[model samples]
Target: MNKFELVFIPGPGIGHLASTVELANVLVSRDDRLSVTVLAIKLPNDIKTTTERIQSLSASFEGKSIRFIVLPELPFPNQSSEPPPLMLQAFLESHKPHVREIVTNLIHDSNRLVGFVIDMFCTSMINVANEFKVPCYLFYTSNAGFLDFSFHLQELYNQNNSTAEQLQNSNVELALPSFINPIPNKAIPPFLFDKDMAAWFHDNTKRFRSEVKGILINTFVEMEPQIVKWMSNGSSKIPKVYTVGPILQLKSIGVTQSNNALNGADILKWLDDQPPASVVFLCFGSKGSFDEDQVLEIARALERSEVRFLWSLRQPPPKGKFEEPSNYANINDVLPEGFLNRTADIGRVIGWAPQIEILSHPATGGFISHCGWNSTLESVWHGVPMATWPLYAEQQFNAFEMVVELGLAVELTLDYVKDFHIGRSRIVSAEEIESGIRKLMGDSGNEIRKKIKVKGEESRKSMMEGGSSFNSLRHFIDDALTNLQEGNY
Candidate 1:
């Protein structure tokens, strides 16, 4: 009869926030005694869309026990000398006091504060949870494989006392428990090559092992059975992990509010006209975009492949500016001349994709993605096979997992690093893109296509009652209640 409350602190990105909200929704829906209050953080680059998305989510949960509280946005710090990752870390750290204030007021209201479900990047909030004498659970917005890799990397770093330069320079293949084969040096994320970012992740992984009660990963057991088993049974240092996913936002969560609704409608209508399993959908993650040269290569490949396609081509934010990539005012300006007219019969290029809707369509057969964890899960859930083109972050590692470990996707390239710090590591040529498209859409992709279809059904089954993810969610809830009853918090 006692009611319990969980506070969810999501990271700044839309992907992180969306998955966290979905998890919160699931928790509250599973038990009426449970309630969730999401402490939303505004994206640093774009506040308007962030606020609008939060508002939309709040509207969707109207009258539910889930509540959203947008945190006060802080001004960008004057740490120009620091790397962007470190700067973002500091920005999140600055919210500690604000979090403490909100939690204090919640307790004063007689709410039974059970735990703080913080995003992976917001591990610093664990300190705030400790101060309030509540258990902290990390909502890992990524897959278990990535989490396992992080722990392994941290172990290696501590054991060797190695520098970023040393690790990058060495041509060593890491035999990690997460992957079936040894991960080559190039496949490792480029961020690990930077001293500051590597150190930041090292510290974060330590906190994950030593501080949190459990990590609730946005992945299912069937997706990464070996790595999930390794985290739960093989390693003592790893915290208790609950695989309760694929946690996805099936609804359009207001990100597309900025885009024209008619455009979204027309895109879907176009998809309806295509033959079943014919169109290969290409959308990088929200921040995923390319320069003129890369765009031209993709345009050329789409034209050559002659595959029905929907390409979400975004214009990268201006250098040194902290903003989301905007839609091209005239996409033709950056694309090859007459490319649109030439491919008018075979493809359609747009911006700001309605990904879930598109993938759910019968016409969508393949995905060319940036391998962001959310996008990966969505693709799997919808039974659309992917051709991996990882742009940054842990995406390269994710690409490796899909292509090498799970055999669920075709590989375009894994080690493509396109960010302000390093720029494009290498442009994927039109020939390579065309080949990948052929493999994804042609007969070459039949095996992977069949595999993803089965996995998609399994993904859905996992979320149903008595299924793996459902049972995992129940276990997580029971553990939280047990902690409360034992006064462990």
Candidate 2:
């Protein structure tokens, strides 16, 4: 009998887990020839606030018999603070033994084990696979644009801030339309600006190039063709890359993820009533938090735009009149006061939303987003035009690619320069916001919207029966299994 197994190793957050679990389901649904086990590493003590915080995706992994190898883990910071120093390096050193042991002990017979699927952060797990001499693939849930940016970080020591300055300072141009610099560097996370982040990024890019065997990105071909091309053969010694995604389609297999810990029913119902191309959907990924002033600016801009919208406001809750955003009750009160009253008739402000469902609804015209890769892909899958407000990480790159390269979305007014003393804190004003809204909600966005709708169709096509994503997935399984069957295991 032939068999295959994947070790689902996700990083320290819900986003990673969400992507991992969803992908795992995709792989499983494809055929009975494969099974997967999850290695859920917990963040200790710090997230003891609630059991819910601790097990972000444990319920999804339950009773599958694929085994949940819960490793006793470290405590990461909440929303703020740098990861513990040398986190990537330290995490590798600490988890290497556990990864090796779990493979050796819990996975039962070695003859049955076919391959390892590790997370991007779990590079050390690749080493364990090397020790075991099985093929290993690195899975990243972020956008291909972000991955493309990460791949270039290897040249940062030599590269300048041209990408950053242009994208952030109200300059949006695709450096290479044939290539996907999906988001701009400016909108990337401040971590990329930190000395620590720079160093770690440099090291990881080098490591990924040298060490990994294959790269599995959770995106589709039509979404970022340039990125897919670059990853497949861009740099020296990088592994084969695969683009297979919008894996949310796998939910049809009857695997349901628990609702995220927020309310979004109103957003969904409101969307249900609006006509197609009429309502704008606004959301900052769960990760984005803004000061009250910033929140007010965003809301005022939306109000001024006079567009019907469903805004998911997730700022840290305020206290008294004006409290520091960093000091919040439950992290949901960051919106400016009475601003909702001004737009109450036109907009619905909620604490959290069913973003994918909302995006899929016929009523959602365009999205005002922070451009997290998952959100980016979700919007693309739905053919929704975007007003890109990239807050951090590969968002800037995603924004750039969307507006300039793909011509599917518009990058709204936002400049993020890490440590520039001047103009580093610029917020897109209400007027610019309104204009962007009008563009996406009006005739100006129609052409872009139609193009993206076609692109989204292509994305789905890429994952259909004989499509690129589907074929790549099929080959990954067959190739891994053939290697195992040939006694390479």
Residues forming the 10-long window of minimal summed lDDT in candidate 2:
318-327
Candidate 2 Cα lDDT to native: 0.66
TM-score of each: 0.97, 0.82
What does candidate 1 score on TM?
Answer: 0.97
Q: Which residue segments of model 2 deviate by more than 4 Å?
A: 45-66, 77-85, 88-93, 155-190, 233-236, 249-262, 317-337, 417-424
Cα RMSD for candidate 2? 5.3
- Residue 208 displacement in candidate 2 (angstroms): 1.2
- List pairs with backbone clashes in candidate 1: none
RMSD of each: 1.5, 5.3
User: Model 1: which ten-residue window has the lowest total lDDT?
Assistant: 253-262
Tens digits of lDDT, candidate 2, 1-489 = 444677778775556666777788778778776778777765453234223633534455564434556666654333223443344456545777878888887457642666778777777677788887777778877666666666655654446532333233434333432363434445555555456556666666666667776778888876777667766665534677777787663221222222223245545666767777788988876556565666677777787778888866654433221111122333335556666577767777665566777888898888988877778778888888888886655566667667876787875744543121121356667777888888888888888888888988988898889998999888777777777778866
Q: Candidate 1: misplaced stretches above 4 Å?
A: 255-262
Whole-model lDDT, model 1: 0.88
Query: C-alpha displacement of 77 in model 2, angstroms?
Result: 8.5
